[model samples]
Target: MTGTQPFVLAEQALLGALLLEPSRIDSVRPHLRPHHMYRPAHAALYRALLDRPPDPGLTMADRTMALVRDAGAHAAGITPVYAHTLMAACPRPRHALVYARMIVEAADHRLVREHAVRLGQVAAADHARDGLADTLTHHRHLHRVLDDLHRRRPDHDTATSTPAVPTPELNPEPPLPGNLDDEQALIGALILDPAPMSALSRWLTPADFADTAHATLYRCVHALVLRGEPVDSLTLAWEAQHQGAFAAGDGGLTPELVAHIATSGMPADVDYRARRVLRAYVLRTAASAAAAVGTHAGDPTLSTSRLVTAARTALTPLDDALARRHNAITATKAPFTHTPPTTTATPWCTGVATWPTTGPDPTNPTAAHGPRSGRRP
Candidate 1:
């Protein structure tokens, strides 16, 4: 409700910050200070030099001079760019970020949406996992709330497609995970589900893989692949992820793989370098398969291009995206991490836990041990 709350909300830490201290907004003032703009010439001149890259040698006077030059075009035109510039140079990092965000929020409605789009873009040069996570988290929650509202009552008279819900289920668990080889093994299972994949609608139950979530996730992914439904794997992955079922011990690669399969139509949310490598590999593997098949028959529709294209085309773009995403993940880190951060919510923290001594060992009933320390919860 306060001026600073929007930035807090935009940052996804608003609730947590509010819980910590109700006046977190007071901290944001330095960065988001606004230009008065009533003095158009001075404001326009100031903004022009601020928006573009500044020469290190340029004094404030020189910068102002540049601003004066640009304003021949009426620098303080009140256009989206002008507003964007004003906010971007708020003279404080935090305040500037807030103003930039506010500009984007406002631009979302007007003809100059490009201004908003550019403001929101996470450039490869600027992308920090932390910042991306922060920004995306806020937008994601907003999207979730709006979607819930939209679904309550559809406009039956309208011809547009239903709001893009991204998935069918809420709080879907992630696939069980494993190492890279484990991922491959899980894929193999889907191709050959020993229990018969068709029985998912009737027999598959969460409890079946209670002790081995990774296996359960694989089975679930196999089921979706079998159905060949049109949906996003990432969305389904969220279900598993939200339930803390994504990591290896929880559920593992299976849910992630499943998410990849479901999201065949989109890019794999992977970092570009990692994705390219995967795309190249997929292309190469597909080419090799086509070449081998040509030996068996007079090229029975098995050109290298056609084969690779067919394989990629067979699944939605999201499949390649998942592969690409997995590639991104593995590029920097190991195939499987020890545990996800959320796993700490459990009572146990150590991997090799020792059992409590059973009443000082029954065999030595009188073996007195002095003042034992209590086990802290």
Candidate 2:
């Protein structure tokens, strides 16, 4: 069959199964498990649909696949395979196998062909599973023993083109001068943009990210924060509105260590937007945890889901308010304080960026809400 054909067929097959009983997902689970003859992208799309606002006419299976496509998921068959592989890496690979099988069987040869490329691309030494022969298999296991390995590998720094090291006394290049709100508006974009779209997109949105400066700042902070480095103390030779704590020498955590802790199972691309969103989420999550700690003495509140819920509840109102204000200013091209600077000495330092800070922000109208959160702001 053709490429789209298998998607339709697989979608229909799952829909039929779902019609009998939404809870009967496992009944068809056998067809999707790992090592199955024909592996489809673990009908991950279908399973992902279970967690959304109700949509009529379509069964959970159809909606799940639809969501996948909307997010630019390609190679209907490969989708299942990737899902399976991901699950294999999960603490429990069983569910990944089931979902993968369903999508595979539903797909046709065309999907299989295209998807083969991706499977090969990611199936490198690092992603492959390892264990039996060598106690530490797979890159993940190797990572568990990274410090030991680094100690053994010959030190051959490629001094010709090496990235600069961040230090404690560093003062990052100053960002373009701008008013607090506009700079923050830029920060708001950075803090909210999701680096990768997945099932989790339905849960929350970051509240504060604004622009590229925020994005850079966020990446620097996240890279440092994940390493357990102090955000409030570090100093770096970088400058961006989100760079406050990061430049301070407290990149919160180191990059390698941070990657290990952010188990969201997706990468936070070091892009201006993605990093910004990550920074906001990480910071706010930390803030919430801190707040929870403080309030624990007063009342027992701010459970993970509740705090996340509160953020979700406030997202719409906050976004709408920001949009109206931004549009009104732009409609007249009003002389605003947040406008970017016209000249720059270097792309990284002066090209209309914001220098991050931890001080009081008057424009932080919805500081109460974070996109990934579920509590009330």
Candidate 3:
């Protein structure tokens, strides 16, 4: 709550600045709106500013009083006098955009924080229930909420004039249940000791992470490992900051989080941890593919063959992984050698003579020739 106090001041300043200089509303309008303000009174004032005519002939004070009166702010316990107080308190009208931006950022933070709290509640409930089906459902809902919160909003200026476009719904399948503690332990271990990077890289990558912050952190760590650079808390934090991963006001890669992960679990079984991460990723992908197939299976436009093909493609990753493992095992086994027979066998032959026949054997005295005699000829 204390952190949000500045946004309250910013909202006041923005409304005040706009009221003092109505012309500046155009610049602030693209970045903010009435709902962006934390306080309802400030929000109402912003709406008033936006509702005013472009060339109102009335003085600013008179316009504010008329708007407040029309809005029945008196009955709502807000008055025109408060409006005048805000207008007089604005330090500079030129900084309206800055104040508007602050309000917008605060609104975004509020949304994220509210959703996070709800997510925590749902997760706790699901844990208490301890049902696999319920857990999966809760996780899917959480993913949807996370996706919505992180999805980029269209620019206010262009969004007003542009035609609405439909976007395909994202896959509804939730990621497979994973041991995040194990994942964190592996990553922390890798950072604590880069010697395992080469071995672990074969089984896991940054994309294997289900959490965005962890993914970003892992990517930084992967980069450092590839470059032969040290990867500890300090280096990881520096890299994350440099990459702007922590610029957004959400959970991000930080030294404290890293240290906590490092100490949370044993880092010695990193190879096994990497396998678990990879397995979770594979299962998640498979589930997504299955869900996609199920969704598209009933569509009249799609052929059964296409659905089958898609299903197969979706399930191919596991098959490929298994195949690779089999090949690796085959490669490590002993080579086979063939041995020749000790003795040669008789050659195969048809029962026929290889001599030319000239009607009959003329030199033989008792020789019967041609078709009349079935002799040696």
User: What local lDDT score does residue 174 receive in model 3, on the 0 to 100 scale?
Assistant: 44
Ranking by lDDT: 3, 1, 2
Per-residue error (Å), model 1, residue 328: 21
Better of 1 and 2 by TM-score: 1
Residue-pair clashes per candidate, as listed? 25, 66, 0
Candidate 2: Cα lDDT at 23: 51
Candidate 3, lDDT over the whole model:
0.55
Query: Lowest-scoring 10 consecutive residues by lDDT in candidate 1?
Result: 340-349
Candidate 2, 3-97: lDDT as tens digits: 54433434444433443234544554444422222323333344443433346777645754455563335235434333333333333222333
Best candidate, lDDT-wise? 3
Please, what is the TM-score per model? 0.18, 0.16, 0.39
Write out the backbone clash pairs for model 3: none
Query: Could you give candidate 1's per-residue lDDT for residues 21-60 as a string of tens digits?
Result: 2233345333322252224443444344344444557664
TM-score winner between candidates 2 and 3: 3
**Each candidate: what lDDT?**
0.33, 0.32, 0.55
Error of 3 at 187 (Å): 25
When 1 and 2 are scored with lDDT, the better candidate is: 1
